[model samples]
Target: MTKHFKSAFRQEVAELVVDKGYSIREAAEAMGVGKSTVDKWARNLRKERNGEETHDTPISEERRRISALEREVQQLKMEKEIFKKGHSSLDVGLNEKFALIEEMKGSYPIKSLCDAFEIHRSSYRYWEESSKKIRPEDLRTDIEVKAAHELSGGSAGSRTIATLVTSGGYDLSRYRASKSMKRQGLVSCQPPKHNYKPANKANITIKNNLNREFSPISPNQVWCGDVTYLWVGDRWRYLATVLDLYSRKIVGFALSNSPDSALTKKALSNAFKARGKPTGLMFHSDQGCHYTSLLFRQLIWKYQIKQSMSRRGNCWDNAPMERFFRSLKTENMPKNGYKNEALANDSVRDYIYRYYNSVRPHSHNLGLSPNEKEGFYWKASNWLARKG
Candidate 1:
């Protein structure tokens, strides 16, 4: 009597010889089939895989071919599902691909998903492990760093951003903030480097009485002033600022089309009035013609304020004012400048009053804003006076 076997069993026997590298005699013995039958099935399957037309394919080989077709259909369905999840193209970021793989790992084989995404299995595994280790707090820090950078008009560096985030009650360190920025691909806009010339002797008769004594015991006791140029429309506009040495605050500022003594006097007048015309104030500024002009001299004497000038061609004598202007231009002012004088005035006003004094973190103030620093000072002073 002849022995009979199922087509599935025959294909299994053939696959043992064709795919599992088993000898034909071994496969036939293992499946209880004849060696000649195993040989015929293996040959037909090989022909199908090699794209050769083969007539008289055994039933076992046909079943193997149908299994291959079904696998291909399943792969197509998986790819369609991936596309529907917004990962249709390989142009997606590696992180995104890794995330998608993780999401579908339970539904599909990781190796198959990796092959479909054209990524190495090892890379997906590494990403999966690294993702598991990321804490939620680190993600929040990244978001805060990005927000602080944007708040500074994309000009603040990691240190500044870290200070801003910390001030917002996060306690983020500069190094950690820097790492977050790097991970998020956030880069700060930097200003051009400035070269200063060697300082010469005091040419004018006015002594350097302030002598770079930037720090004072109280607001209105010492003030520094300087002028910077801003491009407004077709002409350059000058901005003069008066900074209180006690708090790095811009007590008063004036914008003008000319860098004349009138501009400096107006800035001084604004400061004097704003501070309730306080007495015994000393004003320090560079030896610019505007500050040294006779008209500006009379205004200072009228206010009974001692006038001090930086050494000729020396900016350090009035360092606080220079730093304030540098911060203004780099942090908030537009790169190409304002469209008109009115707009320039408004922008400068907003930066000095709304952002610089009230919001920005000043290193001189030990990470406190100008307003915050002054508020603390007054609170302490009032408490001390009451205690006294």
Candidate 2:
């Protein structure tokens, strides 16, 4: 009696040795075939895979080339379909690509599609099983939410993330943002709240002249000043800023190793010179020793500017300045601080002049940046002056 086998069965058995790592003897033992028979099958399969003609394969040169061309055309067609549907394979997530593969599986081979998308077959199979419970729209929204969160340096909360997603043309709400964040285990980075304690009263008497009136009528009418400490070069450095309350703009700033009357005076002097020494200006600040010192008071009198002091230990009296510092520390400044004074100065300068003044949206300015608000005010003032 002679043994017989189908071509498909023979090819599959031979693949155990050729495509898989089985030896000829091992494959023959496993499949209950003769060792010589297994060797011949493996040889023929190798030749076929390499497009070479064999006695049993019997494929002509032209036929082999035509088959190769046909396979190339099929691959191109599949790639074109993927690009048409997904735009770019790299732009989508692995699970999303697997979903696409499932959608087009009837049109093309699953293994070929997985290979084209650069995804492993095992990963696709796993995703196929797990993706059944997840909606495609939810997956897309999660991706958008993650992207928006990263773009905000992980500082955006649910509301801000929702706004960012909407700006990117996605219809995401705060609820969805929160849900996605929870699903992705993403938590926004937030600065710690400070516990301010009551301090001694000011040595010199200056009433709350601005009296918590934050919004001024015009530029140079009222300016507020404050000092904050930054860690640089393994020590504390001080930053003093003068803000025009009308536009919430940092008109002047100074950085120094000392937090004294000189630092505050220099900041104020810079603001006065920058604003062309406008008269009848009121400068408001907290009752810190730097602001109440005799040296600082002498400079205030020299500039002939009115001084207003916040109520002792009351931060809300100078709330705008406090808010500005909070934004700077939370949004821009590095948590571990800068490596050197020069780097710190540069970072502060860019944050003040570029991002804070020109780009960041301010609620007080009705979402306009500081520079934009000031520009609008100047434009209106000029128009009114010209009309008069």
The residue pairs found clashing in candidate 1 are none
Give per-residue CA lDDT, model 1, range 52-165, as digits (tens). Answer: 765653445555577679789999888777767644676888877887888888888888789878899999888878866868988899899999998887878888899999
What is the C-alpha local distance difference test score of candidate 2? 0.84
Candidate 1 lowest-lDDT run of ten: 55-64
lDDT of each: 0.85, 0.84
lDDT of 2 by residue, 184-264 (tens): 888877567777774545425798889889988999999999999998989999999999999999999999999999999
TM-score of each: 0.67, 0.57
Model 1 / residue 266 / CA error / Å: 0.8
Model 1 regions more than 4 Å off: 1-134, 192-195
Residue 152 CA displacement from its true place in model 2, Å: 5.1
